[model samples]
Target: MFKALVVEKNEADGKTSAAVQELSEDQLPEAEVTVAVEYSTVNYKDGLCIGPGGGLVRKYPHVPGIDFAGTVETSADDRYKPGDKVVLTGWRVGEAHWGGYAQKARVKADWLVPLPDGLDTRQAMAVGTAGFTAMLAVMALEDHGLTTGHGPVLVTGAAGGVGSVAVAILAALGHEVAGVTGRPETEDYLKGLGASRIVPREEIAETVKRPLESETWAGCVDAVGGPMLARVLGQMKYGSSVAAVGLAGGADLPATVIPFLLRGVNLLGIDSVMQPYDNRVRAWKRIAEVLPMDKLDSMVHPATLEDLPQLGRDILKGQVKGRVVVDLNG
Candidate 1:
């Protein structure tokens, strides 16, 4: 039997609760690969999965962990073999199937990617889905002509996981990075991640009265949507693009089309969950290549399976910072 974080529903109350329990290997869903999960990371979706159904977990008695890094112990698919180091991020594994919250995980071979060079399982979990998505956002921005020496690049929610990693990577690439955050306490943290300037959340959190503001940002990786994103759209420099990664603030985009029409601003939607495997591999490679190991180390907030219950609640309340890497072996 292996230890796993299980969320079971109470039929009496129609509510869900999570706990770490021993589960037999045979209880894991049959799949192409069996992984001895070394490390997993908590994501925003994990908060929902650990607490309640959140419409993401269609079934109860669920193991919720959206990203994990481990070694394959067994494989039925030719694409993978025992002893292969692997990382998994999406394909709805945590929500729709048994995930990496356990010491052992069984998943489809197509969902696994060979762990990139220069990164160990622990480092990969530190990058997690949040960092992976941040890399994707950066790649999208670069694909749209974002480059160094182009006015400052903006990263909203800069103190958070995705925002923090984006700030670090963007700064490493020689772009002047401006991080936006509500908490003044994170100013030093953001600067530590290489943000040259800090934009107060209140500065851009409100809906702008004007359709087009001063063309400021050359590029942006927006993790907080809603009014903040709507406001940022108007501030983007002409022909610039914003990679919309998450809707932590709000999903409804209350903004004007003037930015698109007059400024040629592109709002690129970044979906890491359904990204093509080839692109996923490409992004992971880019992350391992460009993202500084020291900086990645700075962003880690370590936790264990037992810490997940409260950590999940904290994440949903926007109380967690950087990345929360769960040490399954701990």
Candidate 2:
């Protein structure tokens, strides 16, 4: 038996509550590999999964953790063996299937990536799905002619996990990074992670009156969607691109096509989920090579499985900063 954070629904009241419970191995979903989950991270999705169903959790008594890093304890798949380090993300494990809120997890080998060299299980979870998505956004921008010398790159929702990692990676790659955050207190924290400037959330939170503004950012990794994204669209430099990563602000895109047609600006959609294996490997390898350990360390807020309930609620309220790495063994 293993300890897992289980979200059980009270069918009578149609409400959900989460708690740590002892679960048997037979309770694990059918899969090719069983992992000794060492670390997981709290994400915005996790908050919803841990609280109300959010339509993501299809059943009662769910385990909610979108990403985890661990070691293989048993494997029927030849691709991985016992003691092999692995990372899991973006296969809808937390939402649609059993996830890594437990000390043990059974998952398909295809959903797992061999933990990249130069990173341990804990550090891998530190990056989690958020940082991996950030890397994907950065790579997408780079593919579309984004270079360090082009101009300052903007990272929206900058104090959040995705924005924080994006800022660090862009800064490390020699790009001038402007981090956008509503929280004034995080200015120093964001700067510590290599953000050259802090762009206030109010400055770009609302929709702009003009469809096209002065070309400011050469590239952007936007985590806050809604009007902020709409505003950023009009401000992109000519022929530049913005990688849309999240919709923390809202899903509505209330903007004109003038930026695309007139300024030749491109808006690239970044989806870390269902990314091809080769690209996933490439991204993980790049993360291992480029993301500075010290900078990543500065962004970490550690927690344990027992702290997840409150942490989940905190994340939903945007009260959590950087990444919340949950050490299962701790």
Candidate 3:
């Protein structure tokens, strides 16, 4: 038996509750690879899965960890073997199927990537799905001609997971980074992660008044969609791109097409889930290569399985800071 955080729905009222329960391997969903999960992380999605379904969790009695790092205990696929370290994110594991909120997980071999050479399971979990998406956003921006000498790269929702990692990676890549956060208290924290400037959320969170603001940011890693994204679109430097990673603020994009038409601003949608295997490997490898261990370490706050329910609530409320690494063995 293994310990897993199980969320069960009350059939009568449709309310849900989560608790750590001892579960047998027979309860695990059948798949090609069985992983001895070492560490997982609390994401915004986790908050929803641990509480109400958030339209992401497909069923009750669910294990909600969207990303994990671990060692392969068994594998039916030829690509992986016993003791191989692997990292998993996306592919809807935590939402659509059983996830990594346990001491063990069974998943398709294709959903797994070999842990990058420089990272251990614990550190990889520190990066988690958030950091992985940050790397992909940076790659997309660079592919679209973003460079160090250009104006500062903007990271929206900058104190949150995706924004935090984006700031660190962009700074480490020798670009000036401006982090947008509602919290004034995190200015020091943002600077510690190499953000050169802190843009107050109020400055950019307003709805787009004019379709063209002064072209300020050379590029952007946008986690907050809705009006904030619409505002940022008008602020992007000419011929630059904005990698749209998440919609923490809201899903709607309220803006005109003037930036796209006149300034050549590009809005690149970044989907961490269902990303192809090759790009997943590329993003992880890039993360291992460029993202500083010290910065990543600074962003971590440790937790355990028992702490997930509260952490889940904290994340949904935007009360969680940096990243919360859940130590399964702890």
lDDT (10s digit) by residue, model 1, range 1-330:
989999999989988899999999999999889999999998999999999868999888899999899999999999999999999999998999889899999999999999999999999989999999999999999999998887999999999989999999999899999999999999999999999999999988999689999999999999999999999999999999999999999999999999999989999999999899999999999999999999999989889999999999999999999998999999
- Model 2 steric clash pairs: none
Poorest stretch of ten by lDDT in candidate 3? 206-215
Model 3, span 163-243: residue lDDT tens: 999999999999999999999999999999999999999988988568898989999999999999999999888899999
- Model 1 backbone overlap count: 0
How accurate locally, in lDDT, is each candidate? 0.94, 0.94, 0.94
RMSD values, in order shown:
0.6, 0.6, 0.6
Clashing pairs in 1: none
Taking the tens digit of each residue's C-alpha lDDT, what string does model 2 give over 42-138? Answer: 9999999999978999887799898999999999999999999999999899999989999999999999999999999888988999999999999
Model 2 weakest lDDT span, ten residues long:
52-61
Give the poorly placed runs of model 1, Cα more than 4 Å off.
Answer: none
Clashes of each: 0, 0, 0
